[model samples]
Structure formats: structure tokens, C-alpha cells
Target: MAIYSCFLGKNLKHLKIRLHDIKLATHNFSDKYKTESNGHTTWYTTELSHFNKEKPSLVVIKHFLPGEKDDEEELFLTELEMLTSVKHHNIVTLIGFCVEGFDMMLVIEKFSNGFLRDYLGNVKNMRTLTWEKRLKICIDVAQALNYLHSEMEDKKIIIHTTLHNSSLGLDENWGAKIEDFQWAIFLPPNNKDGAMSKITYSNHSYYMDPEYAKTGMLKRESDVYSFGVILFEILCGRHADDQIYLNGSEKGLIHVARRKFHTGKIEDMIDPTLKEEIGRKSYVPNRGATKDSFYTFLEVAHQCVAEVQDQRPTMKVVLKELQKALFLQVSQLYILS
Candidate 1:
């Protein structure tokens, strides 16, 4: 098996992991070890004993489907470059990679709690995500995006074109981390946006920025737009592809959400569990979010999905607003205690 050293230059040689070990850890990509499988890629979870740690480290191996050699190589190099250059608490960590012959894979730290989507879109699962937990998750993602858009090395920026619920992973303690950088684009210092004439399509149509879709002008605001959709998902306890939204005139959560916000019936859109009431006749265990917290979250999230790109708040602004919302909830708890 050739090491493909031409692509993995001396600088990256240390990160080039052996293919045999990954295959062994994954039992040669056994079906039982597979965690997720889309047409383009497959994910497997396993433990690697070669990290020189006291105990074996759990990891996720992302295997790319074989395609045109040059195209696959370009995609792999792009994603590898982005992952290797960044380090943040709320960003997924790339442990290493395997590139030998036709097999190409990325080894990343595996979170025990799985993707953020796992805890949403289901009534039972949504119950476990209290208002405080949800707020923290959103704050984590916002911090990650702010770092990518404004605080990268040398002041560079990364436009994460693909931002969706599934792109956010959760650790055992429920800390959120942003993952999946295959579709991200890097911009030089001081450059605000890039023109991507050909836009890559994902299953997240509801998260797509309307302005980018209309003009093919990709900007940091596009990510904010997508993050807004995720915030709504957390509020409503539903996915972007939920059938109710798809049946609407504009066919998206953003459309229905905007309509409700304008119609003064925004409270009707909150997830049923989040509407837990404290009536005098009954004892309610969880009273859900305080009015100030709910509306604060709603206001910023609504602004993020605004029709005009210029109206959307920057990630920095979004982070501050979310933090304010979280504070409202925490303060309410303290008062009641």
C-alpha cells in the first residue's frame, strides 16, 4: 500500500495514519460498526489503541465513497486542510487521516451523545432537552461560528456553507461541537465574501440563505441564516424537512415561522413541551422558558432569517443575544429558588 506522500507532504506526514489500523479498529468497515451512511460517505465508530494514551480512544472514521480520482483527491485535501488548521472547544477535532490506494478516510474524535439532531424532532427526546440545555447548545454553535468567521488564524475566515442540525455533534455532557467541513470555503484576511457560481446542494434546503440562493453570492451571513433555522428547530422541536412545513406555500420552516411572527401568533410555534404551563389547579414540574427568554431568542432568530441578507445579524451579535436569552432563563431560576 503506497502512502500517497505526494499529497501528504512532509508538513502533514505526521497526520497520515496507517490504513491497516483504521481497518482493524473498524473490523474492515463491518456493517455492525457503521453509525451513519449517506450515498456519498459512511461513518463508523471504533476505538483506536495506538494513540499512546492510557486507554483506547474512541473515534469516528468518515470514509469517502470512491469517485473520480482527481475530484476525490481535491475534496479530501480541502477538508483536510481546513480541519488541520483550526482548533476550538466547540469545533470537532481531527485526530488523523488515512490515504492509501483507493481508500480515503478522516479519523475524528467521537462524541458519546451523537449528533444534535438525535435529540430533536421527537417528543420523548425533546423532553430531555430543557430550555437551559437548548440555550447552551445554541450558544456553543454560535461561539464556534463566530470564531470561524472573525477569529481564525491570521484573521482568515471560513464560510461554513453547510450548517444544519446534523452538522452539530454533542458530547456526553451535552456540549455542542460543529462538524462536517467538506463544503466549507476559506477566505483571505479582510475578504468578506466569495463568489461560488456553483452552489453545492444538501438536504437542508430550509437552511439555505435566500439571498445566496438568488444571487450565488456566498457570505458569512449565509451561515447565520442557516443557524437561525437550527434555532427554530430547537424552539419548535422539529426538523427543517418536517412534513408540516413542507406542506406550506413556501415549503420551509422559515416561511411558516416568519408568517407566525408577523401574525402575532409566534407563541403557537413553540414546541409543545416548551409550553408547559403552571396553572393554579395543577402542579407543573417544568414551567419551560420565561417570557423574556423566549421572546429574546425569538427576536434574534427571526432577524437571522430575514428576507434581506443585510438585515441578518453578524455571528458576534447573534452570540451576544443568545447569551442574553440564556441569562434571562438562569436569572428566573435564581429568583424562584
Candidate 2:
């Protein structure tokens, strides 16, 4: 056993620890330093050494739900195994994990900017996130999902059942990375009967597809729906659950945006702050920030949140559209400057 000593606040404690010790301590430390949220499990750490070899900072820890017995334990272990196997630039990197206890804990690289939800919520001024930054973040997240859906070998379709602002983190570069893969499902290849089977159970409410919410059938398209909701949140800087439509047909932000978009009133659906920013320097009436470039981004977001799952573009297509939007925004900004 390795003996390690660290001061916890004013008290110094010494204990025999394993590799998991680092992860657990890190998790506790992260919680101590960051804001807390409901529904998801997190590890808090005071030090962030796990993120980089040189920089040590406090990090939150997240543990998979423990099962009842050894058989149940295996499921958690398998999830960790699959998550660990994934390595991508836009995806949150899993540093290490502990499966010895009834629960499985994973230590991951902590982003200083925090989750997208926190960033958007804490920004006192709505337009603090520039159009270029917003577009870039959107592209980064889409690319991350594209990698998960298409690039990984052993080729399981990773369904991020909880795709929301809270689960997306921004790194120092302002690039977005997809986090919280615990509820992810690994879909098996098409069977002889051309049916696909899903592994893992999910229970996230806000990001769940209405169809999946009603039927419990998981598919790649379900993730697309959730991603669309995330896109809506990013555009409006509002929670999907908070929006109310005039028709009273449904309450989700995406549904409302879809109706407004079809009626040529998409600007009404965007965040007023973003609209004001675009209008600030406009020389013409009705020509604020809601220009063709801006409209293109919203159209992509609209496509993502389409009512029909099949109508939503894959993350790959979304990424390309976002990249184009970002490039155009940057060029326009340069010309304006």
C-alpha cells in the first residue's frame, strides 16, 4: 500500500491509498471548489494535477452508480472500459478510474471555463460571447459528437442521452468538449434482421427525445434530437424547459423555434441580447446582427431541432455548417474592424 499525506483544510490526514485514492480525493476537492447541480454525480477536488502533468488544480469527480452485486458491478466496469477507450481532442478525456468499490469512479480533465450552462448563466451581459466564439463552440461540439458517432473503432454509436448546456464544457481556447458519458449507450452493429441493439440505460429528463421519453427506445436519432435542443439553448441562451410557445401546443424551446422559423420570424426566437449586438452598428433598419450569416447559423440550429428526427442533420453535417458560419462571421468581423 502507498501511504500519502495531504492537508484537508486545517487538518492533515495520512492514509494508505491506491490509484483510486487520487481520483476520490480529486472528486471531493472539485465539489469543494465549484458550484453544484442536481441529478448528476460529481467529484470535487482542490487540486487539478490530473488535468495536466504540470498544473495541479482542484477537480470534480464523477462516479458511476454502483450495482447491487458483482454482476451489477460489471456493468459499471464495462462502461468505464468503453469510455476509457475513447480518445479525442473535442471529447473530455477520462484521466483514470477506480472500479474496486461498489461504485465506479472516473477522474477526467477539468475545464477552467466550466460547463457552457455556467458560462451563459453567469455572463451578466448577454452578448459577452461573441458571434465568432459562439459559432466556434458550436462547431467544436458538433465535431466531438461526429467523432463519437463515426470515428471510434469497435464502432459503437455513443448516444449522449443528456445533451445540454450543462454537459458541454468550454476549454481555455473557447472550444467546446462533450462531457458526461455515463448515460451514453453503445449501439451494436446492425443485426441479421437489420435491427440495432442499445446498451446502457438513461434517465435524463431535459435532453431526452420526446419519442424516447415516451417509448424508451434508444437510437442515434435520439441523440440528434437532444443535440438539437442543445443548439437551441446555445442560440437563445435560455433553457429548453423554460420556453413557452404562443400556440400552447408544446413548451420546449426547439418546438417554439421551429414554428417561428417556418413563419419567417426566426429572429423572434433568438436571444434579444444577440439581436441587439448585431443591430448596434447597423446603418440600415431591420439589419441588426440578424444578417444572412447569423440566419445561416440559426437555420442549422433549426434543422437540428426539427420535429422529425430524420430531418435533423447528423453531427458531421452540423459541424460543417457551423464551421462555415464561423468563418464567415470572422471574416465579417475583420471587415468591420
Candidate 3:
């Protein structure tokens, strides 16, 4: 085994966890303690010792293979940079990390509700995620995007190249959050450089901009495109997959939703659960709350997924639009009740 040590300055020493702590918490990484696995990394439900007392802690421990190439190490550093730079609630919290010799590890908070992929269009949890919960989740995700794409104090753009449903996790209360930032890139402001820099990376074929994928060019709009897919999840309760979009003559959710929306049948795409809710409930002071709110949402989502990048709205604009629809739906549901 390669001997190693982690060096942290006084300011960061508190976050520097010793190897023994990890061992004690995870029982030496025994499979019995493992709760989840993704490729090479594994998640463990363990208790961390804080101030001499053990507290329940849910974390995912990412193990990097020994002797990574230069580029791999650089990518690790970039991920760390992005994690430490962010302090938003809608983004999963970075508990800490470990760097000992050739071995590396990352520890992040584990969400209780798991990924959105678990519920949207899935038989197990679909019924549990009612319309209100789904709407709240959409708002929560929008806030996260607004922070990443618009609220950076350094004026640099942090682009998450992939934003599939699996990358979105929910907390105990169903508050949605963005969990993975491994593919993120920091770029100078677009106006300063005419256009944002390109990311020569890709993953999970479902959600992305065609131009960004083909040209290695990345922009804030790339995330908008992915967010648009997420909006479809909220609207239709569908998950991202080629088959879901390619069902019948539909090329994608955007294509199908666009046609349904233009023809005034957008409600047809709503999940049966929500469809039932809207049909049975006459709580809206007016009959069109469900229709109006759903149309507003579909319109915004359709605009975000526009084939032309220039046609897509900024993250800030998307957030406000979502907020408006959320408020309308929430208010009508309560008052019209």
C-alpha cells in the first residue's frame, strides 16, 4: 500500500477527517454497511463522531483508484473547487474529503428521498409524489439553477453539462437538489469572451443541447435545456429516456409537449395522478386554474428547450416564470378549496 497523508491549514483542519474516523463510521467499508453503489463509488449509512459524540450521518464515499493520470487528478481538483465554492441549500452539502497518497475520496450528504429518477414515471414512488410535491420540487430545482447560473459572485459561469433526473435528489421533505457536479466547468463571463467556453465532455444521452453536444460548446443555455427536461418531469411525471420520448411518433418530450401545447391539449401529458386531481377538484375559484397553471408551466418549459439556444430564457428568467406558476397553482389549490 502507498503511504499517504492529508495536509490542511489551520483554517480547514476541522474539515480534514482522519482515516480512522472513516473506518469507525463505515465499519471498514464492509458491504453490510453499504446502502448504495454507483459504478466504483459506494454509499454507506454511518455515524460520524462529532465533539466526542456519534451522530447519524448519511454520506457517499467516492474512492478514486490508485495512481490517477495528470488529467484525472486535475478533474478531481476541479470538482473539489466547484464543491467548496458553492454554499447553497439546494445543492447537496459536501461533508469533507480525503487525500492520502494515491487514494482519494469525496464525502457528500446523502438525500433521503433519493433521486428524482426513482419517482417520476416509476411504479414505486410515482403515486407518493403528488402534484403539490412535484411543483415544490420544480421550484426548488429552479432556485438551485438560479444560484449556479446567475448568483455567482465571481461573475464566472458554472455549467453542469448533464442534468438528468438521476442527478437530482430530494431531501426528507421532498425538497429537490442538484447532487452531482463532476461535469461542471467554470468559465469567464460570456459577454467578456463573446461566448462561454466549451466543455469537451458528455454523458447520459437523454438531456442536452444539440449544439453543445456536437460542437463541444457549452453555455448557460445547456443547463436550461436540461432543466427543460426536468420541467417535463414535473409536468408529465415522465423520466428521461430515449424510449419515453420516442414512444410512437414523438421524437422527444419537447416535440410532443410543444405539439400538445400548441393544440391546447397540454393537459393530456400530465400524469394520471395529477389528471385525476384536476378533474375531481373544483376548488379553483375559476374552472381554468389547473389548465392555466399547467399551460404556463408547459410554455416556460417549451421555451427553455428551444432548439435555438438564443430562444431559451436565462436561468433567472426561468426561475421567475416557475415561481409565478408555482404561486398561482399553490394559491388556487388553497383558496379555491
- The per-prediction CA RMSD against the true structure, in angstroms, equals 2.6, 7.4, 3.8
Top candidate when judged by lDDT against the true structure:
1
| TM-score for each candidate, following the candidate numbering | 0.93, 0.77, 0.86
Give the runs in model 3 whose Cα sits over 4 Å from its true position: 1-11, 35-40, 50-52, 67-72, 190-203, 242-244, 249-252, 262-265, 278-281, 284-289
- Report model 2's TM-score to 2 decimal places: 0.77
Write the residue-wise lDDT of candidate 1 on 1-337 in tens digits: 2325545453776777898998888888999899898866899998987676479899999998777555566666668878987899999999889888888899999988878788777888898888889999999999999999999889989988989988899998999999989888887787755656457645777789888998988888999999999999999999877888878745678899889899988778788877664112232334578778888999999999987888999999999999999998888767766
Task: Give candidate 3's whole-model lDDT.
Answer: 0.71
In model 1, what are the clashing residue pairs, if there are any?
A: none
- Across residues 107-222, which tens digit of lDDT does each residue of candidate 3 receive? 77778888888777764577777665666788888888888887878776677777888889888988888977767887776542224445533446557786676666678888
lDDT head-to-head 2 vs 3, winner: 3
Each prediction's Cα lDDT score? 0.84, 0.62, 0.71
On lDDT, the stronger of 1 and 3 is: 1
Better of 1 and 3 by TM-score: 1
CA deviation > 4 Å runs, candidate 1: 1-10, 277-287
